[model samples]
Target: MRIGVLALQGAVTEHIASIEKTGAQGLPIKRVEELDGVDGLIIPGGESTTIGKLMRKYGFIEAIRAFADQGKPIFGTCAGMIVLAKRIAGDEAGHLELMDITVARNAFGRQRESFECDLEIKGIADPVRAVFIRAPLIEEVGPDIEVLTLYKDEIVTARQGHLLACSFHPELTDDYRLHQYFADMVEDSMTANL
Candidate 1:
């Protein structure tokens, strides 16, 4: 299976490294056409507005939506999570508006406030290491959304069908289980379509 890391911004190399650990081909997707070669896509953390602008400027908005429309899995980390959200807190315009969730940008405060923790993610056997850096928080989720991990009772990880999102940067750590989980999702989607 091949997985793509949206290479427009943020931790792209780290994400690619993690995905490769899952025994899948990891490719950096810098153009809309690259989406066609991957089974799943990972949008890494960065400035959401900037990423949104770039995605739109490069004609990736429609292409990625179409890719998701095919029921292929997508994983969004940190700022990428904000991009995937249908609603952003404080009435900010949403980007992809794909995942059925509301996000509060930089809900964790400033860069100095960034921290790391081991979280008990749902469906994962043990705690997974997570790094929260000026991260966003999932304020609410739609009925179809499954809350995966909560830190201090605040939603940090969630899943809605083929879409998965997390407020923390999982690729920053050596733990590849979360990436492995997403790889399984991509693998499953490929199987179901067969």
Candidate 2:
């Protein structure tokens, strides 16, 4: 399977490395046409506002939404999670608005407050290492959304069909299980369509 990392901003290389660890071909996607070559996409952590602006400026918003409409999986990490959120606390507009969740930007506090922890993610047998840096929190989720991992009683990871959102940086760690999980999602999606 091939996976594409939305290279608009944030942790693109780390995400690519993690994807490659799963024995999948990983590519950086900078243009809309690049979307056609991948079975899955990962939007890495970064400044949500900037990523949103760039997505709109480069016409990626519609292209990405269309890609997801095909039932392919899309994983969003940290700021990328915010991008996928249908509603953001204290904000009127949201980017992509694909995932059925509400997010609070920087709910983990500032950069100085960044921290790491091992989290018990649903569907994974062992705890996964997580790094939160100015991360958002999933305050609410739709009925279809499944809460996956939580940190300190706050929702940090969730899934809704083919979409996965995490408020922590999974790519930043050596553990590739989460990436492998996403790859499996992509593969399953491909199989279901066939």
Candidate 3:
């Protein structure tokens, strides 16, 4: 299986490495055309506004929305999760707005407050290592969205259809279960389409 990491910004190489550990070919998706070859996509953590602006500049906004419409899996981490949300806490509009959720940017304070923890995500058997650095939080979720994991009673990981979102940086850790779960989601979508 081939997965594409949106290389517009953020942890492109790290996400690629994580995908590789899942036994999937990880391609760097710098252009809209790159979406065609991959069965799944990852939007890694970074500055949300900058990523959105760059995506608009490079014509990735609509293309990514189209890609999601195809029923393929797309995983968003940290600021990427902010990008996927339909609404952001503040007045700023969302980027892709693909997922049915609202996000609060920098909910976990600033970089000085960055920390790590082990989370009990629903599908994964063991606790997953999670790193939070200027992370966003899922403030609200639509009825169809499934809450996957919570941190201190706040929503952190949630999934809606083929879209999966996490408020923390899963790629920064050595755990590959999240990537594997996404890969499996992609494979399932492909098989069902076939």
lDDT of 1 by residue, 1-194 (tens): 99999999999999999999999999999989989999999999999999999999999999999999999999999999999999999999999999999999999999999999999999999999999999999999999999999999999999999999999999999999999999999999999999
Which ranges in model 2 have alpha carbons more than 4 Å from their true place?
Answer: none
Segments of candidate 3 deviating more than 4 angstroms:
none
Best by lDDT: 1
Candidate 3 residue 124 C-alpha distance from true site, Å? 0.5
lDDT for 143 in candidate 2 is 98
User: lDDT score, residue 18, model 2?
Assistant: 96
* lDDT to native, each model: 0.97, 0.95, 0.95
Candidate 2 lDDT tens digits, 78-148:
99999999999986598999999999999989999999999999999999999999999999999999999
- The candidate with the higher TM-score, 1 or 2, is 1
For TM-score, the strongest prediction is 1
Ranking by lDDT: 1, 2, 3
Q: Candidate 1 — which pairs collide?
A: none
Q: Whole-model lDDT for model 1 versus the true structure?
A: 0.97
Cα lDDT over the full model 3? 0.95
Of the pair 1 and 3, which is ahead by lDDT?
Answer: 1
